[model samples]
Target: MASRQTRLRVISLYKELHRLGRDYPDPSYNFHGKLRGLFEKNKDLKDEAEIEKAIKLGEYIRNETLALYSLRKYRHLKRMYPAVSPTDPFP
Candidate 1:
């Protein structure tokens, strides 16, 4: 039997992933498909240890996704407004 905390974490992770997926490129196809496939693939996991491992992996993936999004946003901003170098001061 899974603990209440574990179950809640699982639910939270699932919802967060889907929510983030909407912001992901190709949300309708690639992101959703891959997300669904991953959960489905692990649907039958019964061992507590395995489930915990999966949860940890999911958390890691979530963090990575956020990092990627941040990097992409930063790049886009940089492209729009190129950074000024300290050595080259002036408009």
Candidate 2:
């Protein structure tokens, strides 16, 4: 059986990812469903090394999701305000 700490951390990570999936960029993709499915697929892992590896992968995914959100915001901002040129006078 995995240690209590490990179990708690896994649950917390799952919750975090689930929350992030709420605003996932692609409306066609079911992020929350996919997240749950993946977690279910790995729930039987008994080896610590394997579990750790999976957690690391999950964290990497979380980071990538945040990056995607940031890029989306950047695109929106860029669209709203075109870059000013040197020749343009400040308003």
Candidate 3:
């Protein structure tokens, strides 16, 4: 079980991620486009092995970008507010 501080931090992170998802016009604008462009430009990633590698790489990029954004927003909130009692469940 998380302590009150940890739980509050997690709840705050969720809220920020929700906000970012709504405010972000282009979800793929960050890593998806960049990685797709990278793969499209690469001539060597045409075969099955290379294609799989590209797909994995793209997935990694997307996950990493999302995780970074989540952490960034969490930090932003941590700096902005103190821990609350979490009156309601994380939305």
Candidate 4:
């Protein structure tokens, strides 16, 4: 099970990503690479508290990058899952 802070950070990241994804729609390696890097760096954090903090920051960065990258896609996404919307961009 994940820590409370980690879970909270994860949720925050999702929101941030969804918002960003909604503003900019694009499918580029650079965009994905940066998002992936954020996750990877967060995973590298050793201390639990530090990891949680990094996770939160990672989520923010990832969401912003994704949102910027997929703004158009995000707009169309609202039509699919109006409630959840871009929260699950893959869907």
Candidate 5:
């Protein structure tokens, strides 16, 4: 039996990941569905150590996904407003 802390941690992580999926670029890829499936696949873990390890992995994935979204947004903005060269003085 998993401790209450572990259970709460797992639920929160799952919710946060699903929330993050809202901003995912490709709807057809079904990011939320994949996340759900991953959580379901791990629902039978009986060891605290194993659960913690899985939680850590999920956090890592969340951070990476966030970075990816941030990069995409940055690229979009950069394209809209090209950076001016430092050597070029303003008119």
Candidate 6:
């Protein structure tokens, strides 16, 4: 049934979001709590269209979060190991 499919999709999204929350760097930000609150606030949504929209938005957020994390990681690596110039004898 459509409702069952929707339920599965929602659960999948919830699990993915929670997993990402675990990977987030800032514990003080309480990413998991905020993510849970966002879903809880919209738990009563009765319209399939609205639910789909929310799912899309959540996916977008997930992608953006991943990109930002990658960028941060890259910056950290760059700082830890700076580029060596050809003219420099030692790094």
Candidate 6 at residue 89, lDDT? 92
lDDT of 3: 0.55
RMSD of candidates 1 onward, in order: 2.4, 1.1, 16.2, 12.5, 1.6, 2.1
Candidate 4, residues 12-69, lDDT tens digits: the string is 6755664554444445545445655666666555677786677666656775565555
What's the candidate order when arranged by decreasing lDDT? 2, 5, 6, 1, 4, 3
In model 3, the Cα lDDT at residue 41 comes to: 75
Task: Give the alpha-carbon lDDT of every model.
Answer: 0.86, 0.93, 0.55, 0.62, 0.92, 0.87
* Stretches of model 5 off by over 4 angstroms after superposition: 85-91
Residues 1-91, candidate 1: write the lDDT tens digits: 7788888998899899988888885445688778888888887888899999999999998998899799989889989997788888695
User: Global lDDT for candidate 6?
Assistant: 0.87
Worst 10 residues of 2 by lDDT: 82-91
Top TM-score: which candidate number? Answer: 2
The RMSD (Cα, Å) of candidate 4 is: 12.5
For residues 1-91, what per-residue lDDT tens digits would candidate 6 score against the true structure?
Answer: 2398888988898899889888788889999889999999888988888988988988898898899889989999999986899999976
Model 6 stretches astray by more than 4 angstroms: 89-91
> Could you tell which candidate, 5 or 6, scores higher by TM-score?
5
TM-score of each: 0.82, 0.93, 0.47, 0.39, 0.89, 0.85
Question: Which stretches of model 2 miss by more than 4 angstroms?
Answer: none
In angstroms, the error of model 6 at 36 is 0.9
Q: Model 3: which residue pairs collide?
A: none
| Model 1 clashing-pair count | 0
Q: Which pairs of residues have clashing backbones in candidate 5? A: none
Residue-level lDDT tens digits of model 2 in 66-86: 999999999999999988888
TM-score of 3: 0.47
In model 4, which runs have C-alpha deviations exceeding 4 angstroms? 1-5, 11-15, 25-29, 59-91
